[model samples]
Target: MRAIVHEEKEGLEGLKVKEMPERQISDNEVRVKVHTAGMNRRDLAVVTKRHKADDPALIPGSDASGIVETVGGNVTKFQPGDEVIVNPGLGWQENSDAPPEGFEIVGLPDHGTFAEYYTCTEDHLERKPEHLSFEEAGVLPLAALTAYRALFTRGNLEAGQTVMLPGIGSGVLTFCLKYAKAIGARVIVTSRSESKQKEALNLGADLAISTEEDWQEALASEQVDLLIETIGNATFNKSLGVVRKGGTIVTFGSTTEDEVTFNIRQFFYGQYNLLGSTMGSAEELREMLGFISDHKIKPQLDKIFTMDQYKEAFEYIQESKNFGKIAIKVR
Candidate 1:
């Protein structure tokens, strides 16, 4: 099978597509021929030093849409030729406040989807939403699940309330905007790119501001019930300034600086809730699929790249040029 492999010899260099041996499925596992694999920020971090590169040789991607080729003898939920999308977050089956001890992302120590063929336990596969194409569903799992958990589970986002997103370019933020709008929430977003700001407006954002402008002044009169922050130290302090008193702020990724310092007195004085979230649990992933199906929300696809253009695809994302999810055609 052809796969995107990262090695230590290159030590933080980009991934390259190469031949790899296919793994035989275990008794409870299923094998799928990947149709389209979704790329995320972490996928880029896997090949870079932003995240830990634990394995010298690894296939690094957590999202994919594919067709089941073969199932283990014990598997009962699915059979050959089934269209499915993978739930990239493993373990944490129950809807606890945090991921359990066994939780880990799909593509670190173990091989991930960015290949012609991929295999995982039957538990990881979910039937792809019928309304979505392989490319759309390929980008659905990780971003949608994370957004669901961040908005609903952690931030307690409700309809008729205002939700603010610090950055609008990534897949998770795009999903958050779609979900919030589907539920009738007023959405506000900030982006440095004029095109991204306009795109967010088309996607149902009530207000889109340029990050270069003063957020506190621009949104001072608006009531921010919930704020989702992903840019980390770069915008977290500014996010605090815009969120309403007693509002909730949910944070996931640290795309910028890792360490952040904010005034402690202002936090307690304002009675604000600062919640941290990562990927969703299995239960939330299930619910997110239903939500997508019910709302008919389609993924905002930025671009699709063929296997040969993997390098350009990686570079495109690393440069922060994508406005939505990036899909890799594995077929």
Candidate 2:
């Protein structure tokens, strides 16, 4: 199989197209012929992170939508020719507050979907959303699952409330905007890009502002019941003042500074509930696919690159040029 391998070198220098022996499915696994694979920030992490690079030349991708070519005898959920998407987060089947001890994402230690063929455990596969194309569904799993868990499970968001999504261009934030609006919630978003702000409004966000604007001052009239914070140090403190009293703030990623300083007095005084979240559980992944089907919500696609163009795609994402997920088409 042709796979994009992440070699020992750091960053984009390590990415190369190579022939790798395709693994045959075990009795419990299904072999999928990957049509499209989506890129995440963690795909880059696989090459740069020391632990991941320690075992060089691993297939590094977490999101893919493909057709089941063969299913092992023990697999009953799918058949040959079934369209499926992978739940990048392995282990942790039940819906819970946190991932279980054995949990890990798809692309690091285990080989991932960045190949012509991918092997998926039966439990980690879900039928693709009917409303989406392979390109769209390919990017939906990771981002949509994270957004669903962060908003519904962790944040306990409800309709008739306002939810703030800082850094609107991310794939997860775009999913949050769509899901929140579908439930009749007022969605507010911020982005450094003017075009992204306008795009968020088109996507039914009630309010869209520049990240440069004062968070509290710009949203003075809005009472944010839930806040989804993705950008870390640069805007975390500013987002603090935007949420209403007793509001929930769920953070999944800290792209900027890992450690942030905030006023503990202000946090307690406002009765804020701060929570951390990661990728989601299997049940949540299924529910997220159903939600996308119900709302007819398609993932916001930024760019499409061919299998050979993997390096350019990685470079594009590294520069943060995409407003949504970037996919690499294999077929």
Candidate 3:
């Protein structure tokens, strides 16, 4: 199998393509012949060793679509030659501190999908929708599920409510805009570039603004009911500014700075809720796929690169100029 592996934690320099033995499936696992793999910001962080240092020689990719080459003895859901999308997240923990149901994502602390052949536990595989291509299915597990869980499941979004999404480039935010529109919610997306604003408008955003400074002023009349903050320190304070009283804010990325300064009084007095969401459950992943299938929502791809050109792909994402998900065709 052709696999990307890191023997050390020295960033992308450690990532190299090597011919490694393909994985053997366990009694409850299934082996997939990977077709397409999606890259996330976390993949870069993991490759760079900024996060998840427990495993050194990690093959880090979470989203993938492939054909099941073989099924383990205990797996009854799928058979050989079945097309499937991998759900990188397992089920939520049975007992959590506050929330009893909280999901644990894949691609970290476990072997991932950045190779020609990969093994997944049977519970982590979902049937690919008939309408989607392999590239589209490969990108939805992490990004789309995260957006669905944040807005509809965890954030408790309601129809006629207004949502303020800080960034519009990533796959998560793009799907959030699509789903929000389908549910009759007004979406206000913020982009620093005029080109991104126009792209967001084309994708059904109610209002797209290119205000590099004081984005709150861009939303002069709307009071945000739910805010999805993907850009961290750079716009966290500004994102909180336009959110209405009793609104909720869900954050997924800490891209800029983890430490942010905000008035605690404003949160309490305004009665706002600040929440954090990761990738969603397997059930949620399947539901998101169904919605996309029904609505014919296309997974926006910024660029596609071959596995040998993985370095160039990573460099492009590092520049943060892409408007959609970056994909690498593995097989």
Please tell me which predicted candidate would have the highest lDDT against the true structure.
1
What's each prediction's TM-score? 0.97, 0.97, 0.93
Q: Compared with the true structure, what per-residue lDDT tens digits does model 3 show for residues 82-115?
A: 9998887766522222333434456776768889
What TM-score number comes out for model 3? 0.93
Give lDDT: candidate 3, residue 301.
Answer: 80
Kindly provide the TM-score of model 2 when superposed on the true structure, using C-alpha atoms.
0.97
Cα lDDT for residue 27, model 3? Answer: 87
Q: Write the per-residue lDDT of candidate 2 for residues 1-331, one digit (tens) a residue.
A: 8999987667678789999998778999999999999999888777766434456578889999999999999999999999999889899899887889989999878899999999977998889888899999888889999999999999888889899998888888888988999899999999889999999998888898999988888987889999998889998898888888899889988789878899999899999999999989999898888888988989999999998998899888888888888999988
Pairs of residues at least 3 apart in sequence or in different chains that clash in candidate 1: none
What is the C-alpha local distance difference test score of each model? Answer: 0.90, 0.89, 0.82
What is the C-alpha lDDT profile of model 1 across 169-203, one tens digit per residue?
A: 89999999999999999999999999999999988
How many steric clashes does model 2 contain? 0
In candidate 3, stretches whose alpha carbon ends up further than 4 angstroms from where it belongs are: 51-56, 91-104
* TM-score sort, best first: 2, 1, 3
Per-candidate Cα RMSD to the true structure, in Å, reads 1.5, 1.2, 2.4
